[model samples]
Target: MEVLGHRGSRVPGPENTVEAVDAALRAGADGVEIDVRRSADGDLVCVHDARLSRPAGRAIVRQPTEALRARGIPLLDEILDVWAGRGRLICEIKNQPGQPDFDAPRERTARALAERLRARGWTGPRPTVADLDAGAGGITVSSFDWFAIEAL
Candidate 1:
């Protein structure tokens, strides 16, 4: 039913990059699946790994979102822009499983991205952001960490 376009990218380019996601959408994908994480400054980006350096090469672990944007990695807004009318989306929030950054304010990251998508509305037959009780659509909060879910 849902032929999800995995990550817009997995390993080829930057996972979840707008370019990667746009490629999938153009190839007849019904929706996009992407990973999200908070940057050092608590900004959300479409990064799959726990740290950008691991997949990105080098050891720039705690780079700010703006730095990643400058490198053209892609912020949430960029990803959405590329995937607009193409299809649905499965936003998987990255939990930074092994390497924990206690300093990262993940809750704020989630709420921020959630609010952004909510403002966008679905612009579709069943927009994910439309028809919600509050501006809480487009965001499906789920994680192994119960505390995290509760935080959202």
Candidate 2:
């Protein structure tokens, strides 16, 4: 069985950060899972909470991507850079109701994810070994929001 690290082994570093992902991989994890959210500017960021207490209780959806990144929050692209092609990457989209950045019928978050993957040259239901060998990471997108999944 493949051993995937949840939140990239939060024990070693802050959850959802690049450091945590590296730590998990060093510890022999077969893959890593991370949470994804959309910033106010529509950039995908790696964060689990809708509101960040560490960043002065600011709402992630209201904060710009650069602002969050400056405060030590890694962007989704950063996490992907560290984990992609090394092993499996599971990105869980955070699009729950009551949270900021929740798009009802539009599924903007999901659509954005699809576009990002497409930009990265992901075109199949799943990446084949050849794709992985060609430096495309094996990725899985998941979300609690059914609409987001449907959109993906």
Q: Which predicted model would earn the best TM-score?
A: 2
Give the residue spans of candidate 1 off by over 4 A.
9-12, 54-61, 102-106, 122-142
Clashing pairs in 1: 122-127
In model 1, how large is the Cα lDDT of residue 132? 35
TM-score of each: 0.70, 0.88
How does each model score on lDDT?
A: 0.63, 0.86
Best by lDDT: 2
Q: Candidate 1 on 1-152: residue-level lDDT in tens?
A: 55667787543455678878877767766667887777777667877666555355532237877787776667777787777656567777666445554323446555665677668864234444443323222434445555455555
Please state the error at residue 94 of candidate 1 in Å.
Answer: 0.7
For candidate 2, the TM-score is: 0.88
Cα-lDDT of candidate 2: 0.86
